[model samples]
Target: MSINPRTIRWGILATGRIAENFATDLALVEGSELVAVGSRRLDAANEFAERFGAARAHGSYEELAADPEVDVIYVATPHSRHLDDVMTCLEGGKHVLCEKPLAMNAADAETMIAEARSRGLFFAEAMWTRTNPNIRRMLQMIRDGVIGTPLQVRAELGYAAEAEKTRMWDPELGASALLDMGIYPLTFAFLLLGEPVSIVAAGVLSDQGIDVNAGATLTYANGAVANIAWNQVAWSDNRGTIAGDAGFVEMTSRFHEPTGFSVTRGDQTETYEEHVIGRGYSHEIIEVADCLREGLTQSALLPQDESLAIMKQLDEILRQLGVTPR
Candidate 1:
């Protein structure tokens, strides 16, 4: 927590597809600038920097972290690299917004969060779904009792990825339906209802021991329950529904980055439309900027503890599926 900069200067730590998307969204945010790009190869970094209109390109992540002009970094490395990549930014005296799943497991996520806490740095997982406009509004409505005493949640997010994405089938890389896709539904349930009391999970594991498809029933203390599933072998409807005694809300297809949602009470249904900025990634970027300018260490919108809780759930689900937690 230093003097908050008027215009946050951002750095990208890996020029992957996520990084490209982030950079695109960052441009849409006010009072933010992408000052630098980093990658293992200088050529890749240079290309990304040029394409993104970044002024500096570092061949190594270490070099990018050391750049004094960079107020914060967005780490877009793979899930397996989050622990190390986030630590590098923290060690370099920079704030960070790392990609989702935070880490391979809760333990590693704890280590990263603790380091950020000890260093008094702002850090967060880039769980953009939480920051999407429709999701935020839905959360408010649920809290306002638009849906009274949410009793059950049904959400599924999946797509065919095993054939085209080698990383999705690699255990060493920490690939699993739970980490890559299921986290949305899990987090969705957690947001609407608090943490569950017990979780019963089952899944299909690949020969490599990574989960290819999984489903879980999470029961809460108040008898609330959530049925969520994810898959890498096929396409799901990608919809989510939260039901309560009074009424319910249905998040449209690709619920994670929802197009919109309708709230139903008896025969009356109210629908809300969403015009998300730059594929909905800009919302998180704006949140990060707001937090930085306000001198907050963590976002209330997506707290560090919540991220850890979801990671713990992810670990438990993987373990139940006979895929050893990485």
Candidate 2:
């Protein structure tokens, strides 16, 4: 956060596909610079930097964290590594935007948040989907009573994931229908209903001890309920919906991304769509820059408390399904 306001310098902490996509979208934003990239392997770092116009490529994450020019670091590693990776950046005096499911569980997530607070640094879970314009409008519309009282919320994200050793299908790495993919549907539900008063979750676990598919019912104290599903076996509709007494709104497939949504009443239905630049990561990038300029630690749009609540829910769901422990 000590970096000047002239141009926000960004350094990516991984050279994976998400890192590449982020760098590409970051370039689409006007006021940020893709200054550096780092990886365990030096060649991978160099290759990512060369492709993305980064000024420096560090062979090790330690090197990237120690870079004097990097004002912020985006942790794109798997969920299991979030705490360690984020702590590295915060201790190095750089702000962080760690990818979603900020850590494997609530305790680790709170630890990350606490560290950032202790260091007086900005830190956020990179839930980029919440930053989309269409989703923002949807939130406003719901608050305006366009959807009446939310009676039910249902969401699901499913796909046949590629077989990967360390990344996917590994319980130790926190791979599961809920943490890896189901989080989108769960997040969609959480944004609308806040935290659930109680949950009943069940799932099918993989041979590696991860849940391949799962379902949960989140009940709110207000008599609202959300039924959500997640899977890695096959692709579902990838849809999300929130239904109220007056009307209902449903986001199209891949609801987590920048996409259109429709609001339906008893006799009328309205659809919405907006054009997004470069796959929508630009929105969160801009949010980070703005927060930095204003000296804010966390974004109002994506708050720390909400992130912690989501993690706590995920941990509970895992326990219910026996993916972790009861």
Candidate 3:
């Protein structure tokens, strides 16, 4: 990386709430600037651009992707549009940091990875939770045997949403509890247990054909198991626990957000906290900048293979629930 903070000129490809949050966080991170923003509507693009102090605003994704000044593009569109948006950025010769679940399925993620590899452009899924300091510390502790032999993991993330409205219940938007809330716990489990050898799922689908709530049991070959659950029809504790032979780790609510976790061993418990710069999204932006400056095609912290594996897990979960990807 550069001696000075690595400045990455960024173009945002959506004007949604999450995109706005990411832009706000990007501004807080040193060596990063939001140079452009794009939306299907000119006014929305201009509005977001003005709000974020972006240098330019484009009415179409192509315009933002084609901007020579933008060293990279952030794909913050809905999950359904991720593949299209990411492919456009890659084809335009811009590195991409796509929001997760990378695409609607593993096949799409593989295609995106192939394109990035062939083009020699950096590509990564924005699983910002993996970049969080507390999570990193927890993972290190586990690897160092502070947790001893992993036993079982359990997690849940959910919130209530109207079945008649909102994207959470919309089948056409690729909306589901699994894709939204479930991905966090599922990814968390995957990080701890790796790819599971078998998966069993049971869920109740909403009237709109989306899986409103689901519970999954992932059995790993190493004798580790993860019990995960997600719901859009009700609230859950939204906590995570990683239990091991010697100790356990627990995360408070919003496990995917700026987090506070505790490690317990015998009668002693140690708490770890992470501070966010703006909205907690800036940490991932910093990783992207460092990778770009170092001429790396993927972040060591959140590699392409990890993204692909998570997508596969999601695909299997969806399949078990009879929700096919578009």
Candidate 4:
């Protein structure tokens, strides 16, 4: 197979599960190559690079960030480390795609965005769910008036986690039901309806002061509302629905992953399904390639401002619950 010269060279800056999933998807996406993998441990980086067929493996993130051959760096570290990792890459003149909740808080996200802008670099949060084809189609349907004026959106995402052990329950890692799983539903709501005018939230906190289960109601000025819920201590339906004056759209299990959804109105319904390649991560990789080729500094699909706004909402949710960072 011949590789295109225009291919975007991806340098993955972590060897965690999400990093592996994304690299596998990048392998399937044309015009993109995983050129490097970095980890705090040399052996881990080498092993991951070998598994992903990356040409270079570095023991330190700084090495990967400083590599001139790497056109872009994907910061797949934890939420607390995102700002530092992304800024390091940006300082090295490498375009960055940081994982979502772009940072631990909205303030940190603002700093990272400002740094990227100052360097004239491409920076985006890897909100892969926003890049799914079905999501794009659904958003278009809403915009086309197929769903009329969106009046309300109800979405939930959750997974069982023990408050004592997992990172989802750990404050040191910036873990909380809201920051980890909750961001999905929140971002989904924000996508359908822009920033809400007011937010009311309630949460159950663990002994460590991190939220284990959380629910929020967002009110928009146009009378639109969203009920978003997330829990780290129990499983949920993990589905979503958007209701408009005309009809509604319903997504099946795993609202964040590849699945089926239907739009219904007046006894009429249309279903759309997609079986994505490699856990749906390829779609985001394609978006990155397209944007970079077009000389875009940020993705129109997942704008930096929208990401920052979502982070701000998450920060507010945590604040409402009085969960401070460790």
Candidate 5:
């Protein structure tokens, strides 16, 4: 495609649920267009394109990547397939937004990032929370001293998913509570506290060697600590808190896609409610479009280096749990 800065043409490289949600939000992004969709099955691709109003449907991923009308491709495949799929897009000269947990491990993530940087193509792990308005608002407040000096972070996310989904327990698919659910809280802590000085982690692993439940305590250089947990065997409160010297900020349950937040200072508490665009996924879409228009290869909101750092943390956490880092 002759790239149009104002309206970036997008191709969806999968027809899964995440791809559907992303396509839904991509429609809401002002300067983005869903031009094509691809799937292993032509029927599935056609169905997705029809539902999403995409102009073309390709039976194979390569065809979608080679689509001259697509300026960028969204690789919505599972993390296990990310390296190959992302490389395919980059090789075909298409910018990419691969879904979160960018790759199964740091080495693969580094490879994907290096490929994109070498090609001068825009690329980002679609960690949609980083672009959420509520998250951004809270980060700004912390920076503005609303919470003073943050000293601790507590976050947890979990659900009983393995019983119903083979993918949730299958090692071949890189399935685990840590990669699927833990990444959010880990990224949350990283956003508030940066890299940690050291980490102590332990978890319960299934017979298949994937984590069923896990917890980690990260100690930072300035005496700050973040305790994060992830579980696939039960339900959790799913809330998060960042406590600082002067006060604290609490995100409502399901913090990853927070509906609102509250701030407290000694004797006072103030609550904030922000409107989220379609499932809060549209913000990342808007962010990617804006970056493309500005001719940038990365989003400042979720930089490539930060993605790599988080992946390394995940790798370490997995190793601590006695599972070979995927």
Candidate 6:
């Protein structure tokens, strides 16, 4: 783990599996320290803190948010509770890096953004893929015209999750393929093409009213289109691609992480290798630390407008698919 003399004190607001992963990644980052963690149960909180070498553990999110030593809080709670948890952290005078799908809807996201703005605090959606090194290179290639005139895109991620009572299948917890797995592919597509003029979507819902699998087609004003899909019903290629008239870029299956990919054009192909540290969450962690140190409130990589736009697309797609967004 890289250590920085100028440290940013961090407080984790949940003790779930994602929290553990994030904590492990944070340990690998420089200029950050996991000072505190919170969970609904004191035992879980203590266990998380002991496992991650955190100095403080709070039984309730309120106590953790109120901790005067924590400069920032990472909200790793369920999607249904994201709005409240983020507000709690912001209200307690701490910056926040909330998990993806920062809120249940665009309206809630707007509220979170406005609250952060009014407080002059740093707030960002933790779309970690946006900070991946290879993703950055791929986007730069597209921006530098490696792919001529982007015309169409395709992204897919799927897995078979059959537990009916778990958070992945329970509508009460805002569970769905779209929010759980689709956001990555959707955000990937949004990075390539801005807001779409129209979106067509279809999906199959489980008995709990959550989407088991869903697909969407986004048509941009520039006539570019993206076909993206996500599911919890079956395993698929889990590949992502960007195709243009001149060339195409392909991310290997499970493109969200630090994985190798390739580019091809005119019978000549080039492959790029990925070398990253610590589950790839460190990039975003370091991004947050850098932003906080520089007094920036948001990241250009994962901007508020982009997050909101993606949320709108998600809401619209779910609406069209007859799924009530919680």
Clashes of 2: 0
lDDT of candidate 5? Answer: 0.93
User: What are the root-mean-square deviations of the candidates from the true structure over C-alphas?
Assistant: 1.1, 1.4, 1.9, 2.3, 1.0, 2.4
Residue-pair clashes per candidate: 0, 0, 0, 0, 1, 0
Measured against the true structure, the TM-scores of the candidates, in listed sequence, are 0.98, 0.97, 0.96, 0.96, 0.98, 0.97
Report the lDDT of model 2 for residue 18: 86
- For lDDT, candidate 2 versus 6, the one ahead is 6
Instruction: State the local distance difference test value for candidate 6.
Output: 0.89
Give the Cα lDDT of each candidate: 0.92, 0.88, 0.88, 0.89, 0.93, 0.89
Q: How close is candidate 6 to the true structure, as a TM-score?
A: 0.97
Q: TM-score: which is higher, 3 or 5?
A: 5
Best by lDDT: 5
Question: Per-residue alpha-carbon lDDT of model 5 for 1-326, expressed as tens digits?
Answer: 25686788999999998998999888888889999999999999999999999999999999999999999899999999999999999999999999988999999999999999999999999999999999999999999999899999999999989476877888999898999999999999999999999999998999988899999999999999999999999999999999999999999999999989999999999999888989888998888888888888999997999999999999999998999766
Task: For candidate 6, give the lDDT of residue 137.
Answer: 88
What is the per-residue lDDT of model 1 for residues 1-326, given as tens digits with 9 covering 90 to 100?
Answer: 45446788999999989899999999998889999999999999999999999999999999999998899999999999999999999999999999998999899999999999999899999999999999999999998899798999999999998466777877777788889999999999999888899999998988888888989999999999999999989989999999999999999999999979999999999999878997899999999999998888999987999999999998888889998757
How displaced is residue 209 in candidate 5, in Å? 0.6
- 275-321: candidate 6 lDDT, tens digit per residue: 77788888999999988887889998878888998898888888988
| TM-score of predicted structure 5 | 0.98
Question: Over the full model, what C-alpha lDDT does candidate 1 score relative to the true structure?
Answer: 0.92
Error in Å for residue 23 of model 1 = 0.6
* TM-score of model number 3: 0.96
Model 4, 11-52: lDDT tens digits are: 999999889899988999988999998899999999999999
